[model samples]
Target: MKKPVAGDSPASSLSPCEIPKSLLPIFLKHIAAFIDSLNVVVLARLLPQSHHRRILTASTSAVAASLLSQRQHRLVLAISTPLLQPPAASTRPLLPPDNGIKKNVQGPTFMRKIWARDKQEAIQVEFNDLGQPIDEKSSSELAHFLGAIARNGRYAPLHYKNWIKVPQTYKKEMLTQVQEKFQLPPGQEDWILKSITKKWRNWKSFVKTNYYDPNVSLVEQMKNVPERVHEDQWKELVTFWNSDASKRVSDRNKVSRGHQKMVHRKGKMSFARVAEKKKKELGYYPSRSTLFIECYSKGETPGNEVASQAMVQNRVCLKSINDPTQIVAKGIVRSIDPSTEVGGSRLRPNWCEVHIQVAVEWDEELIRRYGMFETIGDALGAHVAWPLFLVERDESDD
Candidate 1:
């Protein structure tokens, strides 16, 4: 009689006592192999049909050969086709359902450790005058001192345009604090104060521009800003930018004729260009009208505060300096910046300046009827590019 393979039923109607005990182990082994083959088929079915069929066929043939005691057949089946093989790594889902909970618990911790390592490399950890690490306490104390000086105004030089360039008094005060508190030598104290000042200003500038939340504390903001640059490291970067090799490259680029002139076209040419061309053909140059006034100064009138407030609201009226009643043109205040030194060695006003973008409009019928220059020259292109230059006036201004 042929020996029954794994998982085969006993053909004879017999009890367990009737079966040979020696065959029990073989029966169990075959049963386990049969179950494993079933599992392989079930998992392989998750793959594409062709892959699933190939894996199933190879696995079943190998199992059958093993049960039949055909070693050569089993080896051939295993070697010829990758039967009973694990699924492709690419095919396997990265986030398996069984591991989802474990991944959720551990993923953030792993990422945090990685980010911390990267940050440590990027930041220059600061040290106090006495070679102690300047921690949160030191930064807070420095901020308080700086804030006090700013409130006092005279020693702080907060009113100065170049306020960030630490004044002598500010430096002296910082040095005194560092010497008394940190107990370092005068030179070391000076160094620490300078480094801290640079760090503070850099942090403040970033916080002012980026962090819009008014409720956020300054301490928190400073903590979140990037670490202070070491003096030596900053010098390295400066040297690189100002290197002789860099200068030579810049000079060569300036002399090179290979660069193309880039014309930025926002839209079609302005109507003024067409009108101007038409006038030129008729042997007439277009009449000039002061249609726009960009920068206007009302010299130190009604104090800086009042002037700035008015400018912000766009309340200032701009009429012709020559003939105010003529209403040659009007200006809508676009922005106002505190007056800084301009004209590079010529005279400069200390007062704030109103920066206005002009309001110019031309009736299409009027322009066509006049057959001439009712509007100004195209700022963007040859055509009267009014849309590009013109900004809608505020309803209140109207």
Candidate 2:
């Protein structure tokens, strides 16, 4: 009898009893499947009558060798193939039906925290405020926003022609004009680059080696040399005009030249320019004609009380000359002598002045029958108040 190798013994073969005595009760005394294999080795040396001895001896040797070789091959395959495969997972599923019952239930509620009902409530309140009320603003404020032109018409309009200097924004566009106007000779780009490179090449290497050397301080000395050639995959342009880096100081000359003669295309207004020229030639600017008028209304003219009431009503939108905080008509308007000098300066009248005596809230205006230009305040200081009246003619005036 030949001894079986490790698992190839009778234990791997079918036994008389498949159901063990200990497992018989749980398995209900049933028979389980059995493993059975055949191993045969036969050799017979009969008479040399039919050459049976020679054939059987050769066949036996061949079969035994083949079986041993097959076993060795199987062993090698099982050992070597495992080395080629990936490592087994750390944790394996339980056998049979254990996997069906296993599950992990504890995990963070990441999405639920961000999308809570409280967040939706906050957004609802925010959207409700879109229907809030707005207060009504004053019309005078709107007038100021529209570039209100005072009714006095004392000054001229601010047109482009009045400009004498260039605005800052237009200066940036002047560079294009310079390139079109000043073209270099043929191969100038190559020439300029080569010339600059040759002159500064040695200086570049020197700076790289002794960058902090007190002798070479200028950035110009550190640029465009052998070391600054940027062979590595790093920034090569530490200078201006190199890699959009700030060359503001070094490009000063080039940029200044580019902006040469750069100015706003504001043409001089012929009338305004000529006005000053004429003034210079005549030794002085021209002045407006003096307005001398005496108001003398008669025949069923309004009484002092009614006239004063109308005058106050006309100046309802008026502001105080001395202090804007104190209102005019609302404060008080009492009758005073036309020649009365309050604080040494006589009160003057404008074209709107009427001959009436009554009071509203502020200053008293004693109506004057006659008025002169010289009685007004300082003309240079712009304190002289006057109405730019458009006279309405009545039949009686002719």
Candidate 3:
């Protein structure tokens, strides 16, 4: 067989129906290659037949073509090119027949029947529109279905393999339960169950893989994001995991999504119970943080007040965050050399208490005990508050 010249109609030169079954795949492959090579303009010029135009419009639409990436759209248009040509002059009637059909009919009226028959053939052509898969159900139906499932608060159910293996009677029973819970449409139970199960498996896999480090601070971890996904997409995914939806889903499934878990404390507890008990017996009451407000004493106040205001001094211990009423020290604050190294770590904030003494300043104590020292310092070392603590005027009439 001779190779068809460029611009020649392959369908007109060779019979599409008469092609040998063994050679059909090879022939289709050649056709596909030829179509892929042609540009949109060439394709538009080639497929002048009305039925071909309709097929192009129905399947590989202009909207679909435009949605695809430049390279993909070009291929879409090329594949839409027509296969056959207009009928020959010889095939036309020599004289007017009793038949009512007109002589000047459009391209290949005889081939129109063949085109209709080819439509039934098991030829699968797909066009990527860069859109979600076509949904047989309406948007409203889908939304309603999803809303029903969400109301139940049950997500990420069992696998599809398990779902498929269950006996038809059991499947029906499960579907009935789902239907009652979700208030789904009567006949849609099976579809809803399958959709829910498949989606649950997918969601489970996604959450399982994407759960970031629980140990690392979220703020620090965000500095170096994953490279696999787009920046915006990664941010969105992070936001989603941080959202209540992720929490609810994880809680329902008893799975950890790597988010920070909140611990609930019923009451405040001291760091050293026995020591605190002994101190309490010694007439040392827990000093409330709110009561020990950093107050401006009108005139030149002590170095401690100045240091506290500057956030260079922290009198309260580590346990103070939970119970600010614990461990209160009273002393005058003074600026220190931050450059001076202390145990291989610099005194970063450069503020310390001078004249060195811990005074029992709270009025609640019946006995005021004072500790005399050369240079009093917090054994816990420098602690700075990122969020500035509240300071108020001493408000004394004096």
User: lDDT per prediction?
Assistant: 0.36, 0.27, 0.36
Note the residue pairs that clash in candidate 2: 204-225, 240-247, 331-361, 331-362, 332-361, 332-362, 332-363, 333-362, 333-363, 334-364
lDDT of residue 237 for candidate 2: 25
lDDT of 2 at 128: 11
Please provide TM-scores, in order, for all candidate models, with all chains considered together: 0.18, 0.14, 0.18
Better of 1 and 2 by lDDT: 1
Where model 1 places Cα greater than 4 Å from the true spot, the runs are 1-13, 57-398
The local lDDT score (0 to 100) that residue 84 gets in candidate 2 is: 22
Per-residue accuracy of model 1 over 180-232 as CA lDDT, tens digit each: 43333334564455455554544434323343233554334333321122223
Model 3 sits at a Cα RMSD from the real structure of 26.5
Clashing pairs in 1: 269-383, 270-383, 270-384, 270-385, 271-383, 271-384, 272-384
Clashes of 2: 10
Against the hidden true structure, what lDDT does model 3 obtain?
0.36
lDDT of 3 at 151: 24
**Weakest ten-residue segment in model 2 by summed lDDT:** 31-40
